[model samples]
Target chain A: MGIQEQYRSEAAALLSSGEVKLVIGFGEGSTADRRRPLFARTPEEAQKFVLDAACIANLSTYLVTEGLLSDGKKVAVFLKPDGIRSVNILISEAQLKPDQVVILGYAIDKAEITALEGRNISDFSLGEEIRSHTPPPHILQEAERIEEMNPAERFEFWKAHFSKCIKCYACRQVCPMCYCRRCIVDVNQPQWVSTSSHTLGNFEWNIVRAFHLAGRCAACGACDRACPVNIPLRLVNYRMGKEVIDAFDYCAGENSSQKPVLASFKQDDPETFIL
Target chain B: MSEPFEPKIVAFVCTYCTYAGADLAGTSRLKYAPNVRIVRLPCTGRISPMFILKALQKGADTVLVSGCHPGDCHFTAGNYHARRRWTVFRALLAFTGIPEERIRFSWVSAAEGAKFAEMINEITEQTRKLGPFTQYQELQKVIETQSTY
Candidate 1:
């Protein structure tokens, strides 16, 4: 049987046997082409769960949300490889507990799911391997194109793109890892990012937002998928991710036991830039 | 033709070491630049990256965070953690095109009063040469104009 078929059956069995209170996965949206997150409470509902390229939302975002993970109920999340890393980061930050989650690793397309089964899916050993997996040709070309631009051109290119943003924050809303109870953008006393939606506000909002997710973002591309305006927000995140990896030899969401790169320190860290 | 540009320096000093060291500099009459305005915290670990950004946004020409030397932190490992955080934070600042000289971090224990004085004088001199922080003002105007939306 196919991996999707196997996942559906497994989900069905888990739900039927009372192993989980709910199974969260993807299902057909209100329209035929759209896919949306599904909350499966029964065995029959579990059969509706689908794993496809269109299943783009990072399901981990629901872990910390109120009324999503109840006191005694177990949450079974269908995660892609990157999605699993997000879960690891959340668990390490003490935002989610291991016992509270039942992760079902859904293999991406023809990729082998058995090689990854029951092992800690949050481990980042696969980061380099995943990067090697051929991205859609267009994405690779776009990333290369951005990398070729100088910083000023890169800044202007982003400024122009962000100028179109309406500040809907759908990008923030749909990200599984952006589970902060009080987002920095919402603080008004000092007004970190302007509350309005203008060019400068949009630029600051996007820059700071991307920076906060720098070391922790697992490159799930959920923010890019969620942006209503289709801003290439993940490009900024991807650049920062590469920088973190190159600068500190650290990768986020690889190990729950490892301290976050930004939260810990080394005595001989590079300080050539300091005055 | 113009008033001398006295750069505003906000120094975040840890209570057990740098803060005490600054106090010692004062008591010992060890002269240093008068541009620095100190905000004392219990430990350097308590200083958040947001605090540093806020200081820059609010008109500090330069921001300095001084703490206990590694292994000498009153809280055992507070300065160690701060050292790691500052390393990453400074990288992000550089990525954003902010001059790295504007943000400084150092380890100065209570016995290093002379060293602390020298650090301050050095920072003040460097910042005076760099002049006031006009980048923040430009960004602020950008924010103000963009806020209309």
Candidate 2:
């Protein structure tokens, strides 16, 4: 059976047995080209579960929104590798609990699963898919090149791009990791980011949003995908991801037990930049 | 529009090291740019990324974070944590197009009064060449106008 068929059956079995209150997965959208997030409450509904390249929505975002894991019921989530990482991070951040959610992982290929399990991927096809599916080349290249530029050039490049933003907040709304009950930008009293779509407010909003996700973002590409104007928002997150890894050898969501890089301290961490 | 530009520099100093170092600089009668306004925190670890952006939004042309040298932190590892956080924070700042020189991190022990003075001199001189942080100011204005609509 195909992976999708197996996942559907397993989810159905779990739901029918009352093992989980809800099984969050993907379903065929009204159109063939699209897929939508699915909340399977019954074994019969599990037939709607589908897994494909179009299943790109990070369903974990709904863990809070749809109240799937609420009411003190165990919720089961079907996670792709990226989704697994996001789930792990969310769990570590106390956003979700392990017993509260059960993860059913889906690998595009078996060898990819092996690699994730800390085993070598001997299958060339699986390896190729995983390699080709890594973060886009332009993001990696730009991240490296940006580090080489002097501060002024770096500032100019970002300002030029951010000036084009319309303050849609699509990036903020769509990010699975941005689950704050009230975002700083939305707070009116102190007025963190201006409520307008002007250049200064736009830039500040983008910067603040990105910084807020620092060391917590799983580099899931949801923000970039959700942007209406196609801002390369992941570039900011990816750049921070690289720095976190380089400076502390830390990767978000990789280990459920590890403390987040920004939230905790190590006596031996590098402080060469300190005065 | 040839107004004399005075860069607004926000310096986040850890109370243990750089904050004490700045006090020493003051007590020793050392001279440095008066452009910087210091925000003293218990440790570098307490300096959140929000504070940096807040400083920028409030019209700081540059933001500097100073703390104890690695392994020299009075809290034993506060500066180490700060370093890791700033490493990522700095990269995010750069990616957002904030000028790199506008944000910096340094280690200055309580005894390093001369280094603190030199650091300020360097940041002030570099910021002078880079000019004011107009991009953020311009955005702030737009945000203000939109809210009125």
Candidate 3:
């Protein structure tokens, strides 16, 4: 059988044997080229799980659906290396219990799909793999080009993109790391971030969004793809991700037990910028 | 429109060190620029990045965050933690095209009153040369005029 069929049968067995209460995977999307999240609870439903190169929404997001694991039951979910990284970070952040998450890990290269040889979060050792993983070359070139621009030009470039924001927050909804009970943008008493779709609010919202995910982001690129206006949201995440590594030697989601960089610190962290 | 421009500088200082240092500057009769408005908190760690953005949103041309030196933090590693946070925050600001020069970070102990006064004067001078932060001020202006709609 093909990799997709193999995983489908595996998913079905997990449900039939009561090993997992839910199997989160990809189903057919509205378009042929697009795939949407599919949650399978029964054995029959598991058969509908579709595994392919187009199945790239990072299904680990569904695992944090607020109280899904409160009962302490296992939930199997389809995951790529990025999704596995998200799980590691989530487990490290105390957002999920590793024992309760069964990772149906897979990796996609080009147009081919292949199953990874891991069923548990700890079975995979991905620290070296994650540290070497770079974003697409064009993304790197664009980031470099942005860095070379004068502050005024950079400001205008981002302002132009942010102006198109309609405050839809499709990026926020799709991020597994964004599983906050109350996001900073939703706070009203102090109103740290403006709520309107205007440029001012958009800047604050986007900044806060990127700031919150600094070293915790798995670089899943979900936010970039989910953005309705195509704000190149991942660029800022990439920048912050790079900053954490270059400045502090901290890579997010390298392992399940790593301490979050911002939460922990050494006295010797570089402070040359301070006067 | 031709009036002399005085840039507004918001200084967020930790109470134990930087705030006390500013007090020393006052007691010593050290005259610094009057452009700064100081907001004192318990520790540098307590000063969130949001405070810096808020200062800009409210029309401040620059922000100064001063705290105890790394080893001298009253709460012992608070400055260290704040140091890490600001390093990350500074990069985020720079990456998003915000003028990194507008936000300053420094260590000010209670004994360094002269340094406090001199730093304030220097920042006021630099901000004066840079002029009002119309880039951010203009963003706030849109909110005021368009909020009615």
Candidate 4:
């Protein structure tokens, strides 16, 4: 059977057997080429399940949405490797219980989608095998290009990019890890971050956005894809994530039991810069 | 001639170590540059990177984060955690083109009054040499001058 037929059958069985109350997958969007998130409760609804290159919404974000998890019903989500890593992070952080998530894993590149034989977050080790793959060449080149520039030129580069921010916050809204009840930008008591989209405020928002996800970001490129202004937010996140893994031998969501990189530290962490 | 440039500096220090060290420097008559204004917190771990950005946003040419030495945190391991955090935060700041020198991290124990004074003198002199942080200050000035519509 083709991959879409296989996905449809698996979703149907899970839903009809009452094993999963909801199967989150991709269905036809308003346009012929676009796909939207499909939440299926009945076996017939599960027939609409689609698997293709364009189904890249990282549906795990819905697993933590406002009213989804409160009911304690089991949820099965169609996932790519990036979505699987997000499940791992969410489970490790105690935000989502492992028993509550059933993952239908798959792999996708620019033009193809191939399903994997994993039904849960643990099935994909996400270990050295996954980490061995280097970052995309374009992101690497842009980061290195920025690194090679003089500090002033780099400053100007970022300033021009950040000045275009309209503070729509679609990036934050789409991020699975950005599950805070009240973000720092919303708190006005002393106002930890400015809410406006001015230059200084934009700088603070973008910096904090990247910093908050330094170690925890799943590197799913969801935020970058969601950015309205086309900011290279993933490159900054990739740089910080690389620093954590290189400096501390840590990779977020690689292992379910590992403590978060920033929350815990060793006695002998490198600190050459500190006086 | 116009007055020489004096860069404003903000020092976020732990009450247990660096703050006490600064107080000891004063009591011991140790001389240091008077450019820095100190904001005392409970421990180094309590000093969020946001504070550094806030200092710069409010016109401080440089920001200093001094805390207990490793294994000497008042809360036990706060400095260690802080050291790791600063390492990552400093790297992020540098990646964003915030000159690394503008954010200084150090460890100054209560008995290290001399070291505290000397470090302050060095940071103040370096910042003064770097001149005012015009890029960030320019952003702040624009936000202040603009009408809130």
- Cα lDDT computed for each candidate against the true fold: 0.76, 0.76, 0.91, 0.88
Q: How many clashes in candidate 3?
A: 0
Off by over 4 Å in 2: A66-70, A109-133, A141-153, B1-3, B71-76, B139-149
Instruction: Evaluate residue B32 in candidate 4 and report its C-alpha lDDT on the 0 to 100 scale.
Output: 91
Candidate of highest lDDT = 3
TM-score of chain A of 2: 0.86
lDDT, residue B54, candidate 4: 85
lDDT of 2 at A151: 69
Q: For model 4, how does the per-residue alpha-carbon lDDT over B1-149 read when each residue is reduced to its tens digit? A: 99989989999999999999999999999999989899999999999988988888888999999999998998998988888889889888999899988999999999999999999999999998899999887874554565343
DockQ-based ranking, best first? 4, 3, 2, 1
Q: For model 3, how does the per-residue alpha-carbon lDDT over B1-149 read when each residue is reduced to its tens digit?
A: 69899889999999999999999999999999999999999999999999999999898999999999889999988999999999999998888888988999999999999999999999999999999999977874554465423
For all candidates listed, what's the TM-score of chain B alone?
Answer: 0.94, 0.91, 0.93, 0.91
Put down candidate 3 lDDT per residue, A154-186, tens digits, no spaces: 888888788778889889899999999898889
On lDDT, the stronger of 2 and 4 is: 4
Q: After superposition, which runs of candidate 4 have C-alpha atoms over 4 Å from their true positions?
A: B1-3, B141-149
Candidate 1: residue B121 lDDT (0-100): 97
Every candidate's DockQ is 0.26, 0.54, 0.61, 0.62
Indicate the DockQ of the complex predicted as candidate 1: 0.26
Residue-by-residue lDDT tens digits, candidate 4, A85-118: 8888888888898888888888887888898887
Instruction: Please give the range of 10 consecutive residues that has the lowest summed lDDT in model 1 chain A.
Output: A111-120
Report lDDT (Cα) of residue A6, candidate 4.
Answer: 92
- Report the Cα lDDT for residue A7, model 1: 83
